[model samples]
Target: MTLIVTSSGRPCAFSEVVEKLAARRGEKLCLGEVVEAFGDRAFGPVMFFFALINMMPWPPGGTTLTGAPLLLLSMELAWGRDELWVPRWTERASVRRSTFRKLIGRFQRGLKLTERLSRPRLHFLTGSFGQGLIGIACVFLSIVLVLPVWGGNLLPAVAVGFFSLGVMQRDGLAVIAGWLLTAATVAVLFLAWRIIVASVSHGFDWIGRIA
Candidate 1:
């Protein structure tokens, strides 16, 4: 559920925002401060902020930290709210400066790569109605992302990243790509569940036959 930047020359790269946050003098960077720093571009940048947090292996409990905001953002966006808001406890969430630094290198690569390629095309997809659908999709993706499921977090995370990037940049193509990925992720999870269930049923049948 993370996203975008502007032509404001403020370094629209999500990684750059992480860099600035890391460069701050404080030992810990609060989630609220990150939200405020995003200004009018709050939706995309804020989502990306939490997404990057989720993407990283560091600072531990990364899923919980990022997932909560992702959920909040999804819900708020679904409601057509312009401003981003999280509960006081969620806002108070923080990450260490050193940890953010550790995440910068690889994380920046993926975000910058997409940023360079993505432009606002397929406008119809990012319109108000489209965004409401995206919010709902993101809500599902965020829930799956936080779950300790068999398919793991990577695919769902990538899907959410695309959704965030698409909405952030008003790039409809990217948003479509996100929906494609989201579908694939859900399919994979469902297949995995089916396999697990079949395997368990087979084991139970064998046990009964042997008994």
Candidate 2:
């Protein structure tokens, strides 16, 4: 396997990143250190990590914890910033190595499948302008993720995850898939909101009738 080393001397590929984390499975990890390890190419993988965390079936409040970082990263991307600048508070965030290792392990199979299908193509769609568009979509989705909408964060998280993968791999086709997923996410959320409103209105009418 071709190993592309980052400035921090860590492997740049997603699988290699996972392997590195696994090797340190019993140690403590800070978010900042992880970001630094990715060096100049921090945005894509870091954002992908946060997005993936939100996509997992973690405990309540996990989405908000992860989504905030995704929001910040997306904002930086949209602003055309060449380097990622995470907030000090966010940088200080820490997690157990075992937890991260388990998370990676759980998703490894799917990640491998995606890697097999991904290749650098449709270069225009993965350029700066396209990244900006993706950032905007991610911003919207991250907001949804942070909200207390029950069962509503999954689709957006998935969309962001796909976008992250596309960016990291320089695969424009994957980016296109992400955009399609984003569109579907929006439609699904709108329909769900409408249904909720209708249900609430019906409940109010029934209450009025009883009164």
Give the Å error, residue 2, model 1: 15
Q: Rate the local accuracy (lDDT) of all candidates.
A: 0.75, 0.78
TM-score of decoy 2? 0.89
lDDT of 2 by residue, 34-129 (tens): 776666556778888777677767566667766887888899988889987987888877667777788888888887777677778888877999
Query: Poorest 10 consecutive residues of model 1 by lDDT?
Result: 1-10
The residue ranges of model 1 lying beyond 4 angstroms of the native Cα positions read: 1-13, 57-62
Model 1 clash tally? Answer: 4
Q: Evaluated with TM-score, which candidate comes out highest?
A: 2
Q: Please, what are the lDDT tens digits per residue for candidate 1 over residues 1-211?
A: 2334333435445666666777889888887778767765477667766766676643334475567778888888888998777777776888787887777766767767776888889999989999899889889888876665533566767777788887788899888888999999889989988999999999999999999
Candidate 2 lDDT score at position 163: 87
